[model samples]
Target: AQSVTQLDSHVSVSEGTPVLLRCNYSSSYSPSLFWYVQHPNKGLQLLLKYTSAATLVKGINGFEAEFKKSETSFHLTKPSAHMSDAAEYFCVVSDPRASGSARQLTFGSGTQLTVLP
Candidate 1:
């Protein structure tokens, strides 16, 4: 099983600058990682996922993350911040041993991105 922790609870950035959201994870086996975004009062959307295939994963709206197994880190980043990017982001890991009763995703605390004009 694996679990994730988002290092930052909130990140404020100017609209034209870069954005970085840090995440760290621990797992007994190799785990599938994901980044999901949730706008206020809206459903969550998948940003990117790492399924033991690629080290670097690119997502919509110029976001990306690199999976570093040795470091146990999968951090999300973007070249620029936009107002639309202001949302809550979750770092998630798939629990490999999930059964009928167990939940599927182990989620991070979440990073709230605030884009300022």
Candidate 2:
């Protein structure tokens, strides 16, 4: 079985400070990890993906994450938070090799991020 845990249900940060949101996962096979950001009433956008090919992955809007096998964690980080960055984030896990179309993705509950002035 595969599962993802978002450590925080909400995170608040100043406009210019660093941003950090934690996530951990457990998977039976080599899993494909992804981070997606969703603005209010908007669709989800792919931030990054770790496909067991690279440990350090970079994504859109200056976001990045490292895949840690020992810790079973893939934490999102950004050097400086922007007002536009305020949105809901999600950590997802899926076996790319699973039977079914590649479009099938399992999403985490979510973590709401607030960027304060």
Candidate 3:
């Protein structure tokens, strides 16, 4: 079974400082990974995704993630943190080739990011 683990349940950063959200994954096959952000009372937004292409993938709002096969890690990072960035983040794994119920996505518990001004 494919699974994702978010290292931190809560992360606090000062405004304009660098932000890092750590994630680790385990899968039986080469997996597709994604980072998603959710604002207060808002739906999840896709930050970035990796599908066996590039190791470093860029996403919306200056967020980026690097897929490291050796470490089984796909951690998200941003050069600076903004107040607007305070939200819930999720690490997700999907098996694109699977069918039926097996194709469902596996999501991490979630990481809440707090941007302190």
Residue 55, model 1: lDDT of: 95
- lDDT ranking from best to worst? 3, 2, 1
Q: lDDT tens string, model 2, 35-66?
A: 99999999999999999888999999999999
| Overall lDDT per candidate, in order of appearance | 0.93, 0.93, 0.95
By TM-score, the best candidate is 3
Which pairs clash in model 2? none
Superior candidate under TM-score, 2 versus 3: 3
lDDT by residue for model 3 (1-117), tens: 899999999999999999999999999999999999999999999999999999999999999999999999999999999999999999999986787667778999999999998
* TM-score of candidate 3 versus the correct structure, residues matched by position: 0.96
Task: Return the top candidate by lDDT.
Answer: 3
Tens digit of per-residue lDDT, candidate 1, span 1-117? 577989999999999999999999999888889999999999989999998888999998899999998899999999999999999999999855566587488899999999999
Worst ten-residue run, lDDT, model 3? 96-105
Candidate 2 regions with alpha-carbon error over 4 angstroms: 100-103
